[model samples]
Target: MEATELNIRISFGRKHALALLSAFFLCWHPGFIGSETLQLTTFYPAPYGGYVSLLTTGGTNTVPANTILARNAGRVGVGTGTPDSKVDIRIPVGLGANGVQITDDNANPDTRSYATLGVTRAASGNNLAYIGLTKQGTYPWAIGVAGSNDLIMGASSAGNRTIPSPMFSIDTGGQIAMGGGAEAGRRLRVVGDLRVTGDIYVNGRIQGLCQRIGYSITGVTSCPWNHNVIGFLGDGVARVSGFLPASATTSGVGRFIVLGEDWGGTMICCRF
Candidate 1:
């Protein structure tokens, strides 16, 4: 008779009681209890209605549909193409302070078309060239051309004043010749220290060699010892010509006709 105290009834639907009350508050509040403050809004739909916009607050990640996140401050615009389709920005690792920096606009001047092969800069101040290999300054009149025949080999530095001309020069058909043979075999071959001051015109031969003590004759005649042009008291005096194998008939000594040596004999110091 007391069995009528038993009465039970329960029913829930609206999406199964909101998924069974979200699985009983995710198994009794497992952790992270709502709103550590996060709000993000970004939208780009019809005709890009809102060109671009992004807002984030106390983020844990959001706004990634065409991302544009600006939280504190910003301004960015770079478009001057070509450098391999430019658009590379990366700086974050002790955030930059000198690694690459180039800011130029000295009244705007920069023009380069190609042939700037290795290292070049002539940002408009007149630089026309076919060839220009520079080291220092001042090239008032510089012209160096060697397409086929023009050989300058070795040390060359100008200015500080040192001009010791004549290393080479020969012009034949128009007559301005120099001689050595075979048209011009020895144009110039100077070994070292050679100082000649004025007046030296040798159209053919001015050879030298002499060491006679025992009727020495190596080739190219005339020398018979009478030698006496002893004039030397300083200021410059050495013009002696008379001695050794020049037809030794000795009549008043003094003979030297050595013209490329072939030795014919004479050595008598006192007869002329």
Candidate 2:
């Protein structure tokens, strides 16, 4: 009998007969009717107008049923029956390759449209703003306002070294004016000329300013032959104990004289 007729006859048979006929039909209709394999090439497009289509090429055409083509098309109308619920849309992987290429092309300034990589400010007086690493490893030379045209006004290291203490530092080209400090234990040694307008008070013993007594001088030495007294001595000589004395006599024609006092003896000198 024909396959359709056999199927109709099996449908009305008793339970045991129906089972036997079902097995026979399965063996006979291997590639017939419902047993035929159906390969789906593409899904039937959804009736909705906003449904997105997924088309594939270069492979065996097999698409599963009920596969969501595009979850979110725009920043609105995704999953929600109302379009207002689609706030921020996302076209997940594979679906976004074409869209990304189009966006990149539009971002180029040479193209018709462009999108900014980041926020940018307008040029103010020929100056633009940028963000970058300020220092990598070594110490930077200087840092301050961009174009102020003034010497850095606050604490700075222009003429200073960081390793050593700068208490005795002196700027060669500039005058340093300090105020309101005891200034103890500070020693200043200058190889060049030092002009001081204020009084210098020495708290400790002042050395190396006087000649030693009982020290013989030869003719080759610069010492005066007449044993003229000069500055006071520090250790083995008479130290000048008080303020330096000035010449008492201002003579025009007669011999000039000076009278000074020291710790050992008084000084009386006459010179022309």
Candidate 3:
């Protein structure tokens, strides 16, 4: 065995760590194979703990072909020369595939802080797309995808722990639910009152009770009934109190009815 002293070195400098490892210095070990194979391990100390890199760079004076580095950011990078984030991986074109997949099985349960895939924009811009599996604690999911235009579907982020006020909901049956907490078996449910800015076109029979208030009703007991707004289907006995048909008991059969005061001071009731 030829004797040599190779500095299996480390950096204890301020925060600037740059490893200067030569190829021949690595294969100088006695148990190493031929000159065609090269392997080396380098460790660096940083302000936030340290970093370890295991690299395989072929023969003398050769650059590293593959690297597995674990850095201060709790990140592991494979095939990456310089990592900037967590789980940073880079592979050149014409190599293998470049993608990430995470699945949970019996042995691997989904029990972690926050796991997010941020698809950032070009020129080191902000995130354009994101998908995340969030838990809790110091690592909360930060989604800057589409610059605040991210569309999220389904269950709560904290596994029903912290519930978000329902914006909209859709089930597998192709039924769309708008507004807040969905009804048990309803296709559409709005937590609060629904207001329509445009016209409503109904395919079939539109069953609902519509009434306008804030005006004085000449015939009814309460002049200018100002309570009933707009809804779908209700049962009530409407008594006409004032005009031509005063004290007329109008039977409301839980159907669409538009009742309001006319501009000419007339009580109009249109039932359909």
Candidate 4:
């Protein structure tokens, strides 16, 4: 039951005032018990025009501390009912929001916006790779401080150094090595020539063959300019990828020579 307040100002004796007040209370709450009295504190209005209150039974009071003040305009304020941002947070999940954005607009140089995970192992676990980036499920780029990092495809070098070398690395030192499985020693060391098993898709021009020092492709395949054919035959297979005359292989997989007609003239070729 709601307790009603009466503005009674009596110019009578103190005992008379007490009697009148007690009588007034007894009339309102007939089962008036001992000691308990109505707590009459004025409910203050919130700074943003809403009523500040306590949530009783189901809640803390008429206005609870943890209560979220939201509006139909898709805005939510935490400490203050009036949120400045879309979902304004004064102190600090939600059923609905368009997209989540985390930003550090300070534009500082070395600020990390995303989460960072540092290596927690011992010195034996040194050179442990931290982050790896890839394309088509193959790791092509990586950033790790522990191990030797060398971009292995550009060249093959026999220079093998101690562990903890930079196999492929990128740092503020302005040092890069497109070398093989070892320390590049200096700033840049492209060990030797490159070899691949798949087709080389070149967006730009491909220069002539760069043979190894003191040697040439003529030592391997009679034709020095036969880099294309050399690459095709590097697998030790004699099978031609393009259409080859049946007569070419009909001689039963042994060294044989044959004649063929070409746009220029009749040509003779040897096959094995």
Candidate 5:
């Protein structure tokens, strides 16, 4: 049996103290990766850096097919390496995902409610160009400028990029059209019926049917209200009261009037 015992004298210096302190920090710090996992509850001063691509996978040690990229020119892309806008998201075709959705979490809403999403003019004093509703298999229906720079809402039937004639449109001067042809100085032009329950006014005058009266011409009667008699109702018989020559009964001139002529129609008269 052998027993060994060693005795050493330790001296303290600035370099030794620094080395020991550094080793102490390397053992328990979050950046240390010896054998245990690194868990960070909070970060101080936050993390700021640059990376070509950042990705997260569903499983460990698996690389994701799609990645999020942040470019140096301040563009961020999701599922794409290069983005054209400030923030762009690209979903693969035939995927179940569509576009973005915004939900309002307010459980109780009243008359004075706020919108979930809003589009406004840019800070450069330029108005918004257009807004569109697009589907996967159909052309987009959009509200935008026409070829002449007039504001219009239009749709297409042929292809994705094709712009068909507008089904409905509004011009720059606020004239509206139902058939896509908005003429100048016209307030509204509709191809279909224009129904109005109230009176129609043209040049400060209310337009309506003229007042006239009719009467059955079974006998000779004076015109009511002193209105002028226009014509008789009988066919080929001008006057109502007349004498017909007797032919069969060997009688004198028989007093007769055209009755049941024109199907017992009415006398026409109008106020002049």
Candidate 6:
């Protein structure tokens, strides 16, 4: 039942006023009983327009508990009343709370679940978005999308650092750059010369079995310019006419010669 206020200026005794107020209450609630309860506070407006501090209870006739609160500056809070942001929420008491989750229960397979952050413009060397991980006493690490559209992962040099230097990055074209400040234009580009610990394979076949470092010479005593005789062989009856020196005296010099019978053999010449 709705209670109506009666503007009565009674020039009577306090007992008379109490009797008249009880009669007025009985008038609004016609079916009132001795054991029944009628909370009369609901029929009146709140004292203040908003709350100045956190509200723990709503008195005897109101709610027993409250989980939502609005600040005087129009900030709403959940699980707390002293909000800092526009909509602040904090876990009051929990051991392992996951905080919040944005979910969609639609039965469509191709439905996109989105949690988007949109920024109109970003400063140079800044991240458009980033996820950071930190330990108790270690430098924080982060992986982020740079302002230039490169995906970068870096560790903070200091504890209070905001922007992170890129250790390596993948550009918008799917090319990855290694080392600091390096750019890649090929499919796999490295900043330094490659060193292989194992055998290299090309087109699924092993490479670098043997390399042709020198040319074969048949029946030649002296090699060409910048070439030296590394190995020489003769026929059964032929021997070297002179002593074969390990070092050549002159450029394009050879110590091999035919001594006894007509003899000719190949000479392996190598150039450094």
Tens digit per residue, CA lDDT, model 4, 1-272: 99999897758798988999999877785444423222222344644454333211112333322445555455665434465777654322121111122323323212323432222111222233233222232222323444333222221111111123335544344455554333333554456666679987878654443433222232333324333222221323233233444576475555444332211111122221
User: For every model shown, what is its TM-score relative to the native structure?
Assistant: 0.17, 0.17, 0.27, 0.20, 0.32, 0.31
Error of 5 at 62 (Å): 43
What does candidate 1's lDDT look like per residue over 54-153, in tens digits? Answer: 3322323232212223322232212111112223222223311211223222221122222111111111111111122223232212111122123211
Per-model clash counts, in order, read 19, 2, 8, 17, 0, 0
Candidate with top TM-score is: 5
User: CA lDDT, every prediction?
Assistant: 0.30, 0.30, 0.40, 0.36, 0.50, 0.50
Q: Report how far residue 152 has shifted in candidate 4, in Å.
A: 11
Return the lDDT, model 4, position 28: 83
Model 2 poorest ten-residue lDDT run: 126-135
What are the per-residue Cα lDDT tens digits for candidate 3 across 126-148?
Answer: 22333334443322242332222
RMSD of 3: 17.9
lDDT of 1: 0.30
Model 6, position 193: C-alpha lDDT score? 54
Clashing pairs in 6: none
Error of 6 at 80 (Å): 17
State the lDDT of candidate 2 residue by residue for 25-70, as single tens digits. Answer: 8778644333323233333455534444332222212332112222
Query: Candidate 2 at residue 20, lDDT?
Result: 86
User: Order of candidates by lDDT, top first?
Assistant: 6, 5, 3, 4, 1, 2
